[model samples]
Target: MENQEVLQQILKELQSVNQRLDKLEAGQGELKDNQANIENKLDSVVEQTVDLKEFKTETNNKLDTVVEKIGAIEAVTKENLYDIAKLKLIK
Candidate 1:
């Protein structure tokens, strides 16, 4: 009878140990999932930074073209005004 009681106690202790190990395994799985999510977010941020740089370069080129056109218009207007003044003087 004593041997049977001892065996029962040992069985209970083994079951408790098994339950704790199961909880630890679940926690490890959650940690791995969190790590994967963080890496994905980092990749997205890097892609956005590259896109912004390209847009800035394109905008600068367009601005330069507009400035050149304005300069040309100013030169033409000055010549036309000078011609009109000469015509008035002759009259």
Candidate 2:
């Protein structure tokens, strides 16, 4: 009878250990899911950063072109004004 009681106690302990192991497995699954989500978000952010860099480079090129055109216009205007002044003086 004593041996029977000891066997019952051992069985109950084993059942408890099994339940704890099941809970740990469930927790590990959740952690893996969270890690996957974080990696996906990081990838999205990296893509956006690359896009922004490309846009900035394009904008800068456009601005430089506009500046060059403005400089050319100023040079032409100065030459026309100088020619007009010489004509008035000759008249």
For lDDT, the strongest prediction is 2
Candidate 1 C-alpha lDDT tens digits along 1-91: 9999999999999999999999999999999999999999999999999999999999999999999999999999999899999999999
The global C-alpha lDDT for each of the candidates, from Candidate 1 onward, is 0.93, 1.00
Candidate 2 residues 1-91, lDDT tens each? 9999999999999999999999999999999999999999999999999999999999999999999999999999999999999999999
Instruction: Return the TM-score for candidate 2, rounded to 2 decimals.
Output: 0.77
Whole-model alpha-carbon lDDT for candidate 2: 1.00
- Tell me how far the alpha carbon of residue 57 in candidate 1 is from the true structure, in angstroms, after superposition: 0.6
Off by over 4 Å in 2: 87-91
